[model samples]
Target: MEDITIHEFDFALINEFFTELERQGPGSPEETIRALGFIGNLSNKTKIADLGCGTGFQTMVLAQNTEAAITALDLCAGSIDKLNATAGKLGLQNRVKGIVGSMDNLPFQNEEFDLIWSEGAIASIGFEKGLNHWKRFLKKDGYIAVTYESWYTDERPAEIEKWWLDAVPEIGTIAHNISIMQKAGYIPVAAFTLPESCWIDNYFVPQKARQEEFLKQHAGNKTVEDMIAFMRHEADLYSKYKQYYGYVFYIGKKM
Candidate 1:
């Protein structure tokens, strides 16, 4: 059998799987709000771009809190469709628009936004590269907020570390990431680790029902089964070794 890793698959299956879930990764509305609180200078005229906004879960939270004109972009067409539908249903279609696009190759003009927000998705592009690339889209003093995987301690067991390195080789410690942010020309605003519930409660628990449905939908498919098994193993690993590493919200302001 081929060794199965989630990142190794073409995104077709991965995107299809995540489109069915409310969120693409480990994050909660409360944590979203907490990150928003650290940002300042928002008004009805603020322009925000939310890159890699899978189904716009955090996007909606941001739309509700601030009267900012938001362009939510994602590479997954299915996720963008769902997000647009949700925005219309919630009567926020005026301020929230979902666009299908790649994060690395953005569709916006230079220095066109007051803020750039990405939740649980900046890893698709390397952290430093993402910050530096996306910085051009932000106006002077604009803010960028993102949730990314990072190490909490200087050392960790080889198993989990190796697993993450294979998955996202650029993953680094919080301090290391903050330094990257500074070098990328942003002044670090705040950095905080997400609480455990965001993963177990908001992300994993919700996926239980979805996993069953996904398996049933793609019955007898070996690749799909391997993917599910890989996901479960990831949860198990997090359960066993969460203290060493997890997602952290990093906020910064353009210099």
Candidate 2:
């Protein structure tokens, strides 16, 4: 058996976990279009920046949906390379490509973009902290839409609650998210929970298929089974407790 450390999967399992998927998280092109509507008037010349853009799935969606010149930024060089390759294949080389960097310390000028977007990536930096830190990069009245994890009800089953606490102990409620966005110097435009299809269709389906393939190839590795357990557990938990929490997409504009 090959000894594999946890972070070792950054290139292997991580790539398997998300490959050839249109979205890395719970969002759709329709939601992106709706968020763009809330941002109002915009031209093809609008400068946009997508932070923590894992593999640039939504970045590609943005390019196809809008004429904005997008800079898709991610910390992983491999993901950036993959994104660039996809953009090139799509003939969007000039409009969309990943710029390798971290969301913790943005390496860009102040007010560099007319719109700053991140879907399911802001959690690495706390939601409040992300809103506050990234606001500096948005032009006045510029839009920001981030998909954040939230609890739908304070009362939840003990099992699910424990699972969430073990994962993200401080995940906030929708109202808390809105309050944080307002306090972080953005005018909250709208908020909505992603539908179940966002989880089942886009992410879980592809991830499960890959996990099954991995398990078949590594039949004797308990480590692979254990690793895939988390993903399966999340899907199972959501099946039973979806109404209790969700990935809520929140949109706002810099004040």
Candidate 3:
């Protein structure tokens, strides 16, 4: 979701892997609307910021539903270019614009946005830090909707748990995240776990296909081989041990 530094060869392979997909993360437009439904009263006056908006898939969904101005920010210029082109084609050029930037150093002014949305990207700067850093950019009483990879249960396979611990920080149950939200100075409006279809259907299933294509194209490249192995490891792990952890969406309003 967020940026990860990788070898140049793996980087090329990965950029190719995701280039053709509408969504880079495991989310559907329907799920995005479901989260937006929790926030009431929308109008042209509303302004939104979508952090780490890979290719701006969800950004377009938001623009289509609301008359709000949205800035889709991402670290990848190629992603921003695709987002811009899509926004233009959808005739949402005035409402949606893609910015190439980092989430940690948001370029917008303090209290400028009415809503801040992030999907599977908060971990780039750590969840707690992301919340604290982004709050300044949101207006008073504005909402922030985000999804985080979380531990669903306390008891789990030690090996998988260790793998996740190394991959992401602040792995916790729903209640644990709710506590974190309160500590970050937001009042929860709604919370729910994303359905598994979000992963299997939207993400891994397509990712698997992409991997297959890469194997044929980059046949003997060690970089592609290592990259493919790592990517496959995630899907394989989830296939065997999905119940232990998953992404959960939390909607909160700034206090």
Top-TM-score structure, candidate number: 1
User: After superposition, which runs of candidate 2 have C-alpha atoms over 4 Å from their true positions?
Assistant: 1-12, 217-219
What's the distance in Å from true for residue 183, model 1? 0.3
TM-score of each: 0.98, 0.91, 0.93
- Candidate 2 per-residue lDDT, tens place, 1-255, comes to 123223334456555556545566777777777777777667888988999898888888889888889998887777788899999999999888688888989888999899999998887677888898899999899889888889999788888887776666568789988998999998999998888888888778877667888789779877677777766877888899999998998999888
Q: What stretches of model 3 exceed 4 Å from their correct place?
A: 1-13
Clashing pairs for model 1 are none
In candidate 3, which residue pairs get closer than 3 Å at backbone N, Cα or C atoms, i.e. clash? none
lDDT of each: 0.93, 0.81, 0.86
Could you tally the backbone clashes for each prediction? 0, 0, 0
Give the clashing residue pairs of candidate 2, or none.
Answer: none
lDDT of 1 by residue, 62-147 (tens): 99999999999999899999999999999999999999999999999999999999998899788988999999999999999999
Q: Could you tell me which 10 consecutive residues in candidate 2 have the lowest summed lDDT?
A: 1-10
Question: Compared to the true structure, candidate 3 yields what TM-score?
Answer: 0.93
Cα deviation of 252 in candidate 1 (Å)? 0.5
Choose 1 or 2, whichever is better by lDDT. Answer: 1
Rate residue 3 of model 1 by lDDT.
41
